[model samples]
Target: MKVYILWHVHHVAVDEVGNVAHFENGEFSARENLGDDVKLLGVYSTPDRVERRISVARTLPGFRDEPDCFWSAEVEVDEDDWASGYVTE
Candidate 1:
């Protein structure tokens, strides 16, 4: 099953066009610049549900200021993610 993970980040977020400052090989994409004030708002089963939640959240305080900060990513359930062990430097 696909789940929509909602996230709210606090930062001077940049648009897609200016997100990457360099073009090494081909077009490279990155989200490493997003600041550390990340909030896991909620996870919904459907996109519609995610939309509904976002709409309401946008009307609320704090969130209203950064309405565009809201975003959702679809991920499958019961998936073996990060099977390879990670390292901490």
Candidate 2:
């Protein structure tokens, strides 16, 4: 099974029509955001079936008090192009 690390980041965008959008950009990570260090644990698989979400865990460097920290991020990816880190466009 293939796994990855997805970091969360704050993002902002402005359009030519003066419309602005601000939201969490999951593909980015920064030291200021604690959750950026979280790791995507693995990709769940079922024979002849497709899954809707991926599992993640705060494996390393996360707060000790929250040792069992876990969550899921919605994404669609193939094993070939699983990115290890974020790439800015």
What's the number of clashes in each of the models?
0, 0
Off by over 4 Å in 2: 1-36, 46-64, 78-89
Q: Which pairs clash in the backbone of model 2?
A: none
What are the models' TM-scores? Answer: 0.69, 0.24
To one decimal, what is the Cα RMSD in angstroms of model 2 from the true structure? 10.0
Candidate 1 weakest ten by summed lDDT: 20-29
lDDT by residue (tens digit), candidate 2, 57-81: 2233442334333333444455444
Identify the runs in model 1 with alpha carbons over 4 angstroms from their true place.
12-35
